[model samples]
Target: MNPKISDSIPQEDKDFDKQHIWHPYSSMSKPLPCYHVKSASGVRLYLDSGQSLIDGMSSWWCAIHGYNHQELNDALVKQVNLMSHVMFGGITHDPAIQLCRHLVELTNPKLECVFLCDSGSVSVEVALKQAIQYWDSKRQPEKKKFLSIKRGYHGDTFGAMFVSDPENSMHSIYTSYGPDNIFAEAPQIGFDDEWNEADIEDFKRKIEKHHKIIAAVILEPILQGAGGMRMYNPQYLKRVRELCDKYDVLLVLDEIATGFGRTGKLFAQEHANICPDIMCVGKAITGGYLTLAAVISTRSVANVISGGRTGCFMHGPTFMGNPAACAVSVKNLEILRTGAWKSQVDTIEKILLKKFKPLMESGHRKIRQIRVLGAVGVIEMKNPIDVALYQRRFVELGVWVRPFGKLLYIMPPYIISEDDLNHLVYSLISVATDESLA
Candidate 1:
């Protein structure tokens, strides 16, 4: 079929995209019209149509410092000029080394090593493989099963999807596979209440049932992104840590969306005063300048993975530890260390809560629940249609707010000013309370 051409693009460009492009998480037969962003800076995206939109979701929760920051741009430019790419398997680069040092210092004391990958899904896959190998090298080959929480969203790769909640967006075809290697349950934490003893007992039961063969317990930390923006209790995390310790199972925390000051801290585990055996970090690691993710671990996990004759991790992406991405990450970390970004996030959270509190308490039937953590906030609508409608309406209202199933949420760039944040909250309130959505 000939490609459809938009007037905004040159006919050749349109044809080229239609002939060669297969977009991710999209239906090719009936694709959503693509946006041509001319440029972006601060918290706004300027489209080819000449309309400006607030990046309410931080371009999929990654743009921590916002778009087109001078420092990040300069870093990428400087690195590209010096060394654009290099194989990380044997060669070492300043960007990767410096970023790792910063990350080790920023994360828990136990997490001391970093393994670079291209994206969050790949990081999850790497961590899973590392855990399996850790057990195998330790002579516990039977430990292969992974226990995750129900409705948890990891990423799109096969291994990542295997560990995520099977009922989510990507697992329909794998129904026959069933729940043998993967174990899951409804999240124990909720916005309305904290984790209780019963919740802890149920988690313990699940752990005991699978403890013999379980290799690891994977979670999305305090908030489960792509799972209806569900918020869980940190106490549950503490309990999960204890259970993993007792059962000798590794704990893998997927902080791809929560890391780098997004959760009002350097990492979400800080809330519980606990640390995971392994952590998957992405998104804002490079401040959205380039694709990068890291599988960070303790000396113990590193030792196990490195001890084998295979000589450390069996995984490698061509772009792994790309100098350009790492250089950007080093600069991103420098920006975060300034401490001003976190203070801005805290202020934005306070303003958002104050503006949305009434809508949350209004008992609007279409709104099921409200959850806020650090700079991120979510509103669960009554249905999927409601979610789609709100997303579209919010876009028209000059804000880019994507809805996940029945959940509508915002994770604006930390640099957003109070005025922009207030606008976002009001727009969200309007959509949440609109009777037409019901």
Candidate 2:
């Protein structure tokens, strides 16, 4: 938005957007202030206000390869000229075929079959449908209700919301709208805390007592993203897999947020060294270039669903396997294959840990606790923040860190430099320790 440049965009256009357009989780009548982003490249967003900001949220944690990535851009560009989109019902393309193979290679080998969809929520829907159909094929149609952990978030879709924490989540209002599902207590053991065997007891008991009725036991492995960005021990996931095996319950992992090297490992489930019966992947699938997600399942589950009463999976989105999205996704996996995210995440974690270390001793009453998992760093506040107040502050400080609920966190792009990261953390610390706001 440099007014001097011919390509610069005006900030006045946002007024029209604010009046007509509805943003995420906001009412159009009195929408939260919207920032006009004219363009973005790498880890920085160029605004219509002629100010540049270092992106900390990574556009809701999707653009892991950062914005306008060359390889992904080239892949998408090459695909659109051939064909932008086509019905994925019967027709297929090379992009979808290639992306699925790479997805299988990155994820669990047992999760060999991929069901491509438009977004993360749809992928969860596909997983739920797979579980239900698998049970029906086995003549256990009664086992339809899902069992999930408390404070866990899968997606915003009805099926996904039902299995998420019913009472605590923002989606709680829609609890009665979706299917009634079972929920175990949220794991109490912190990510780096001492192993608490008792933490598994409630989950173990829930599965034991309701195994007959539970269609699947679903949870976000190791790190639960939307559920307050909490991280738990990998042992909990390991034990969950064991119990699922013992009780004949399928484990569905929502790796939409934790997949693609976000949690130090390629997938958060890998921390437990276990494979899920059905796994959902999205977010970084195409390096945030386009909308895409996939539900990968075991060969047996795929066979059961295929050989079921309907003779086909019930759900089929029109844009299920978009060629352009798939093409970009193939290149995205190729980028991740370089194994650069490991060192990147390690460096981010170290920077967050070191920078936030002084804040712990600063004893800011507003900050409840500080936690870091891989590339994510969170400041759990004693109370929820005023979104407009903190957002304006972040923009003024030359960074973009969206503060929601009682959590102020940053999940930056993996390619961020040390100086950019330091500034990002500094911005958070400033917001957290700002005595006037406190």
Model 2 off-target regions past 4 Å?
Answer: 1-12
Over 155-198, each residue of candidate 1 has an lDDT whose tens digit, in order, gives: 98888888887766567687566445555566554744745767
- Candidate 1 — which residues are off by over 4 angstroms? 1-7, 10-20, 175-179, 189-192, 309-311, 386-389
Model 2 whole-model lDDT (C-alpha atoms): 0.89
**Cα-lDDT of candidate 1:** 0.83
CA lDDT, every model vs. true structure: 0.83, 0.89
Worst 10 residues of 1 by lDDT: 1-10
Best prediction by lDDT = 2
TM-score of each predicted structure versus truth: 0.94, 0.96
Residues 1-438, model 2: lDDT tens digits: 112221244445556677888899887898987777889999999987678899999898899989988888899999999998999988988999999999888888898999999999889989998999999988999999899999998888888888889999979899767788998998873888888999999999899999999999989989888889999999999999999999999999999999998889999998889999999999999899889999999999999988988888899898989999999999999999999999999999999999999887676878898889899999999988899888888888889889888999999999999999999999999988898884
Model 2 clash tally? 0
Best candidate, TM-score-wise? 2
